[model samples]
Target: MNCLLTGSSGIVGSHIMFEWIYKALVEKTVNHLFVVIRNNKKPAKDRLLAILNDSSRPHFLNDFSMADCLSKITVIPSDLSNIKKQTLEKYNFSTVIHCAGSTSLQHTTDSKEKVQHQNFNVTKQLLTELPHNVKRFLYISTAYSFGIQKDKVTDTIANFKVQEFRNPYEKSKYESEKYVSETCAKKNIISQILRPSIICGRLIDAPFFETPKFDVFYAWAIFLNKYARKASSDFRIWIDQKSGLNIVPVDFVAKAVLHAFLQPNIKELNIVNPTQILHKNYVGDVLRYFKINAFNYVSERPENLNNFEQLYYKTIGVVFEKYISVPDLQFQSETILKFINQLNLSTNLGVHENFMKLIDFSVKKEFKSSYA
Candidate 1:
């Protein structure tokens, strides 16, 4: 199978590429793996070479050690924003995995135009203009695309009006998904969309510093530790006790995507999230893991607290306010579990282990001098 994979430098993309080239499509089935990268980014040759030379360097290096696999992979430089129709005609892509999109939650309507351009417009162009030989166009979308309904969110795609989005990123992705579905219907192209919730760490290595969602928790922990040390009194970050946070590791996400695509008749599948802990539970677990006693409050109590407690509450409040507003963010895991059971791929998704590893990695980096 000749495949076209985009977003090779991204966290999800890098993981997907590693799985597809090195593990799943190894040896015979994959004749050529064309990696579509933006020209302005790191040169594809250099990126691939870096991976090949050292797979343990913390970047997208795990797949690099597979030199035999890399030989079959070809890097194609093309901007998804302005990919020429003629250029796509050059290669016969049996499968096109679109993983490129801005995952930023802070983008405004005007500020997010470029992201929308890349996510929606570019995808529209690719599906509409691509050669007829393309069999499947797989899009990597976010679970948040289900919108901030706060109620039960099913794995099935439901129609959400444009104005209902919680943030510009969500709105843009929804718009892009709409366009892809519409265009695919018109073009008669087979397409599948995979919506993954907040992807955490890999069991083996870090994906990238720039695309750090799972790593942010570690950073937050470090920041809190530093703040605690710097502060004159007892320190704690306050969080709501009722809200839940959905976090899935990168390994499960990659495996699910691959499994969904490789399955005989399956068109779409939402990877069942194994760890959907309540926000307070999540924070409490991390704090407990680190031996930090966090004072949890059921109601807003900023007025009674002293300066240090007030500041810490304010800091955590911001993050809570942003994410807590997301509707129906709690994902259904039965589908993902069914698929995993059916495939009998390694039963250990390692969600907690991977998260703990991330924390360990950060703690080591933060206190290397003192520990050494």
Candidate 2:
């Protein structure tokens, strides 16, 4: 089998590439892996070769088999937004995985126009230009595209009219997803979409450990800890103690996406927050696990009556005060759970220890470097 993967250098895309390589080695299903990357300044061929040949970086997440198997991969240069049908036809790909997108949540309305245009244009081009020999098209989308719907969240894609988005990233994703779904349906292309919620590092092993630290919430929490200690404040933030904070690990998301690819009659999958719990309670659990004391000041009215609060809220692209009060901010992941069970897979992908280790590792590194 042959496959083409975009966004091969990104956090999620890199992990997906490793996971697929691992699976290919184990199942002996794929022989050639074609990776398409954007060539802005550096040529795609040289950049990909450098990454594949690098021995210093931990590209396989402690799995040597994946790195070894990566030798069978081929790097291709193509602009996703304007990829030609002839270029894709040369690969004769049996499957195409689309994972490229601007994940910058802080992008303002004005800043997001270019990104949204690229995303939509690229997807449309891919759908129309894909070789007929390709068997499936898989899209990786964000669970946040569901917006702030607090009711029983279903697997169905969110209707833009129902929920209001705060940032361009979310708006663009929601729009792109709709376009992809419609185009796929019209063309009768076998397709699957995976929506993952806030993916954090492995949970609760240590503060300074060997793992990727990519969770914004965890990063913010660590930053808050430093600022709180330095300022001699109680580190209290007002929040609705009853709201739910949905989070999943990156490994789980990758595994779920791969499993969906192998399954039959699986059109759409959500890999995040299958089960929702109270946000304050969830955060409290994480904090308690780390032996951190956090004071929660529950208030009916919004707090932070200063310009700093306004600026901070705008910077994060989230109204922390309003987020705490969202009654139904949970992702439904029943499809992901069923798919995992069907595969008979049991691994430490979603364990809390991994996340904790990453957090500690980042914090200690910051402290030692005097960059905290």
- CA lDDT, every model vs. true structure: 0.62, 0.61
Per-residue CA lDDT of model 2 for 211-284, tens digit only, reads: 33344455455544444333222334455766655666555566677777777377767676555546565555
Q: What is the lDDT of residue 305 in candidate 2?
A: 34
Lowest-lDDT window of 10 residues in candidate 2? Answer: 202-211
**Winning model by lDDT:** 1
Cα error of candidate 1 at position 236, Å? 6.6
Single out the weakest 10-residue window by summed lDDT for candidate 1.
Answer: 208-217
RMSD to the hidden true structure, all candidates: 5.0, 4.8
TM-score of model 2 relative to the true fold? 0.79
* TM-score for each candidate, following the candidate numbering: 0.80, 0.79
